[model samples]
Target: MLTERFRFLLNRFRDRLWVKPLAVCLLSIAVAFVAKFADGTGMAKFTPQISLDSIEALLSIMASSMLVIATFSVSSMVSAYASAANTATPRSFILVVSDDASQNALSTFVGAFIFSIVAITAVKNEYFEKAGLFILFVLTVFIFGLVVVTFVRWVDRIARLGRMGTTIEKVEHATAAALRRRLNAPNLCGVPVRSNLEGLAVYAANVGYVQYIDMAALQIWAEQSKVRVVVAALPGSFAAPNNILAYVIADSAERTDIDSTAVALAFQIGGARLFDDDPRFGLVVLSEIAGRALSPAVNDPGTAICVVGTLVRLFTLWSEPEPVGGKQAPKYDRVEVPELSARDMFDDAFTAIARDGAGVVEVAVRLQKALGALAASGNADLREAAEYHSRLAFKRSQNALSISEDLEAVAKAGNFKTKHAESVSSSDGKQQ
Candidate 1:
């Protein structure tokens, strides 16, 4: 719960524009203070041999150059976000937009510019004329060096930020990470909430995707009230006044005066679902990209195949065992949540791809193989989903393919048994 809370906070912090630059400026100011205070100290002996005029010139040039670079970078980033939404998937725009590298790059540039202005102003005003000259000079050199290094790194990172392959990889990695976490804690580390239990229905005041649930807070409330809280809708569910957000179960009299507002506040509703807690959303976004690539206008089957492989990798992890944690029991014993269904994940991931790529033999083949591989994972749920999708894809491929050879090839792969094996199996069954 604490980890989740921290993750939630960290995620929120990372999405903002001010935090990084603000911190950078604060650090710059601190350095300036250090330089100012070190003025009269013998530490000036270590200061590099540099003229104040040269330092001012360097700072002035950096401040002006960095401003232009920052502006260009922002524009470039905007274009990339637009291209990603149009070419790849709109859901991916968020990841690309919140990219740490891009944000850090921009922040560094802006921060550097601010640092330069402050230092230049201080130098021109004679604030460090007689004292702290060495400290100021040294710090200015360091800042300039940092700016150059950051600019180089930023240039490299910006080039790949919103490209289709990069976007797909980003989505896949995010989804895989989320899936791994879910594999360890399917119910978000809460007690499994029962579906059949009837309790007091709690309604959400707004209509939007449930972005986050403060489970720790909810658990505290449940413990304090001595009642079981069944979360009817988990994060990523669309909630409105009409929807039941949760159910409060009690043994005796109902606590009518207790405001459900606090319970409502626990859920953070947003305009759209995010990939952080919703692995399904990520898978869905990946499928959307494949669907786009397979469109007649694009005809990029290779990308679709690549996406199929990525999905296979994810589901393979899904079939693994829940990672055991430490001896400490889950903190939210009273709160219940449902497990994400493997079938639904399969549906969200492959159903559209199967529908869109039906005519493409290569895609069909790879999809069948991916499903077949998943079927072999031995998790009954995954096996069932794989079998279901394999048959559906097979039927579509049968209709889509005009060539008998391609149809036969796809069917062979889908069956998990080639013609020879099928004949041998028939003979064995008959003999038995």
Candidate 2:
């Protein structure tokens, strides 16, 4: 029964677009006349001679005020309604957050008292003395209120459309696999590639705030390589490199395209951040190998790869292997985990990369040194296992390096080709 009632209400609201405006108009008219009547006799004791001119002036003023007030009120109401209707989450009522209930009540009381006092003063001042004018004032107020209500509703509709227009713009400019592919051609900067892929494709892309890129290119690359690509976080959202932004299937060819797209996208987005001199930009690449170990929902073969990818990336970033003598020691102590922002992690990685030039050989050498030190210090039996795991890490690092190299090659080639072509065209013009 409740469901049926709700359905009915929704249908009614949908059908009667003018219901709110009409109701506001009626309420405004009632308030204007009631206030006038109450003040004329109950509050104000003075009575004056009625005159046509006085009636006309009073009616015009009251009508104009009523119309302006009603228009603003109805506009606010319509905007609130539209916002509530379009939100994904359930709308909560406006709750008073303050704990001072007494103060709030006192304020309300004082406001009402002041309004009454003002109304009485207006009456005593003989603002509504003409009887013929009173009738005209009431009629004029009603008509103006109606006009205000209608105008307000129109404004609300326009506002809602404006909000939708912004959302559409974001989606259009959002980073997708397909978009990455289109922008992949040789350019001044280098070949574009994607980096740090993780997460399912559920949320909308946020633009301008943070990680904004063309997702269409990535999607195209994914399709060509037969990899499933999915984006997770909304655009403008602050995220760490290890944060799962999207998930990609790791079919070899698809993986290559996916990695390429991811790397390109990272460079584009991160470079943009650098250009803007925003210190919060960073990227983290997750290996799909780890994605294969999680539960089906958490690791949905198709769209859930990023969940596992994120886990792997975090593990690589923070975990320390236990001593070799211990029972396959835990990589990380739960208690020691600190809440670190993406910017912090990226900063650390950036510093490391800068010290070592971000070359594949340099990164691998560093990782090996770090791993070797841990192994020798009774941290784990990684020496024997280091070769296996290090190789995997090397592979991941190599992919990143390849993307960077490809981007550079494309950039250099494009520059050389453009310069040569320009020179040739100039020579031809000179000969002519």
| Candidate maximizing lDDT | 1
lDDT per residue for candidate 2 within 311-378, as digits (tens), equals 22332322334322333221211101112233343332223322222233333344444333433443
Provide the global lDDT of candidate 1 against the true structure. 0.82
RMSD to the true structure for each prediction, in A, is: 4.5, 22.7
C-alpha positional error of residue 419 in candidate 1 after TM-score superposition, expressed in Å: 10
Lowest summed lDDT across 10 adjacent residues in model 2 is found at 88-97
lDDT of each: 0.82, 0.34
Off by over 4 Å in 2: 1-15, 39-44, 47-51, 54-432
Q: Model 2's lDDT to the true fold?
A: 0.34
TM-score of 1: 0.91
**RMSD, candidate 2, Å:** 22.7
Q: Residue 299: error of model 1 in Å?
A: 1.4
Candidate no. 2 TM-score: 0.21
Residue 215, candidate 2: Cα error in Å is 39
